[model samples]
Target: DHFVVLFPILSRNRFSHILKGLAMSGRQITVMLSYPSDEVGNHLMDLDAMYKANLNPHTDVLSRQEFRKLFGYTFKHPFTGLDYIDLYMDLAVDNNIEVVLANDPLAALSYSKDVLVATIHDRKHLKNLLLNNGGNTIIGLDELATKQGKSGGYNPEFGLLGSNLAGNNRLKLFPRDAEQFCYAVQKKLFEKTGKTVEVLVYGDGAFKDPVGKIWELADPVVAPGFTAGLMGTPNEIKMKYIADNELVGLSQEEAQRQLKQKISQKGTNLLGQNASLGTTPRQLTDLLGTLCDLMSGSGDKGTPIIHIQGYFDNYASE
Candidate 1:
């Protein structure tokens, strides 16, 4: 069996070095390069072509202009970028490179099995796979937490307090559906205070969870824009603005005051016994905000993937 390794275009030099080392050790290597359609426009084009070819029939095919109009006004193409599809297609034709693997899904539409190896990265493609094979229930973070708490019949109130506040106050059984459970909590909070309150939702690895098992909530059941769902453990609050005018006229001090007031009002709505049992502390909102900033920031420092190098070593030693 041939060993395979996936690397980004940025790591071409490193990939070459590794290949040479393997070759010197009297081992054979087959290189399969993948190029991501980093730009939304190229991604849309591939989707459109795939649909036109009857490979994907559910999605509506749109022109480049239509795609821009529907999504946004801006289309950015990196200056130092190369179209890997074109480059590889020509290479395959000239050199007769068999078993070529591609990152773009549209490559399969043009190249034959002898020339192209299809690799799917799109969410819709994955969902379709699950759907075709007797679909599995994708549970969210809230639901998963509720399931974990069900056996013990944990109180929802302790969810609000600090981690140290764990108690055997089995007031009521937690709902199986996390979103429903959270909504029930929200409703109780509103009833107690007679006011509308925003609820912030945050969790990690919602997308990375196994398809057949419980998944994390991507959006809040009640408030979509108002809620924040983030990956990783919560630590520190980050500020997020809904609109430019939300802080345009206000001084920095005034903005901070408004933000805190908003958070407090939301937290107050989730203050009742039932509400507190199901919800977390107000500080979680800030942690979600920080997650968002890290995700949207430029990747000049490094890749998005966080590599905890010594984590396994420390865990094993402990």
Candidate 2:
């Protein structure tokens, strides 16, 4: 009655275990959901379907009645085949629960001022946005078990943001001191082998699935920490562009020699250069993380660790 909780649900596993416990609170809970897809790119409905029905995700907000009517019963996910909307709403153990569909963080204020923000990646920003927009009580899910004891399972940094439910109560959180861990691993690798190998702590990669329309980046970031060597974006020229344009009409051997010479004589920074046009202008970690994540697929086919070699090698490298 007093607390008007604002929960933005992602999937079944995100809030299923706590639904009954929240019901006991008897708070006027307002659940906000992003339509077509959640924050992590889990598509709720097909894009064509939404467009055919004359809906704009940017401006339009849908009530429970409208959502059900438009999408029909059991609008299943493309991959999981679970109707996430129906699943979430059905799990509302309490009559106090109310659902709304929107992308705007400020939309929660229309229902209540006192709200509990339940999002993962955008928790801090959303909380701040709510506070700035006249919210009475604003709390992020990450702030839940920040300083709690370890036996009960607690994360001082992420709290419950990147946590998995071990039981009805216990939540296994994302690893802490990621930067320190990388250094430690680097040190251990140096100790074991004479060569100095750079290390990084990578979570889910920033990869999008064309089939499911879901992004693999459900976590906060791809790489939270890495050695000094793995810092900054890749600074390399486009070999294909160089070969086709600059080295055109030359013999194969001559073109190869010219390419090697160009590589040797290239400037340190290659950002916004015509020679680097075809190259991916992104963080090295992001690229590596995507590659590594693909190598070690999640769920059943997952291997806990992936070994990558020669990633830093370029045409310039001997």
Candidate 3:
């Protein structure tokens, strides 16, 4: 029987025990580390350290192609164009490799074979799993902004600012603000067209803040407010429409009159219905840092894969 288990992190001792247990149970264990050939050597060195400490050397580390061949099929991932981890799971079943340890989330999904699948979510409370005893914290963008104050620090603006900061300070920092910008652009488009539009944001190497440049380049007559102005125009219309039709269930004319009165009394640019979506940039860098710690075996108790014994006992009993 083959099993697929997803784990956030585990201690070295615990991980060693799992490997020993799997081997003791008369199962051939294969540990697959998702890394390129150039990088696999370093990963193997870390695994070697674990093996040396535990004194269990039964597990085999297979390269991507070698592992794929065990399944007797060549399949590429539809989206990533990489070898799908599902193929390896199927291969494990066919080749009778009882336990296969991997770190890819794609491996966590359901597969065609009857292999037992289990996941351990012990690190749900953790922002990022600490590997092996490494002292590193993975924080989200809001936390990052809070830690380093700047206007719109948690938004797409941060990426632009980060580029300038890195250059000015001569610090090596890579910021991935594409995801956040995509959310903002999508939100703006949705407000304008009332339709959910998918946007693919490509990174332009010039990371100097885009806000001022956008304003300078924009047609003053058409897009006076730049990005925020463009977004606000449709937002105002949407809010007025909602106020007229839904808020008090008033007639269109009366709702417009009341909305105008409210705006005149309070202020223009009032908050809209969908203004609180709060899509900020997540802490992807933090996650990367955590992964680096885990892979280097410097993380706190950092075991990349957790082995759960008797994982299929309930299913087998039933």
- Listed in order, each prediction's TM-score against the native is 0.25, 0.89, 0.23
Which prediction has the highest TM-score against the true structure? Answer: 2
lDDT of 3 by residue, 82-109 (tens): 4334433343423543333344423323
Q: Tens digit of lDDT per residue, candidate 1, span 130-237?
A: 334444332111221232443644324222111111233222222224555556656786899995444433222123224322222222221112322222222212
Measured by lDDT, the strongest candidate is 2
Per-residue accuracy of model 2 over 95-165 as CA lDDT, tens digit each: 66667788777877887887777777778888898999999889877777778674566667766666555
For model 3, the local distance difference test gives 0.32
Poorly placed runs, candidate 3 (over 4 Å): 1-66, 69-73, 77-101, 104-241, 244-249, 260-318
Worst lDDT window (10 residues) for model 3?
215-224
Going through the candidates in order, what is the number of backbone clashes in each?
A: 10, 0, 13
Which residue pairs in candidate 1 have backbone atoms (N, alpha carbon, C) closer than 3 angstroms, thus clashing? 139-215, 140-215, 141-216, 141-217, 156-277, 157-276, 157-277, 204-231, 237-286, 238-286
Model 1 / residue 269 / CA error / Å? 11
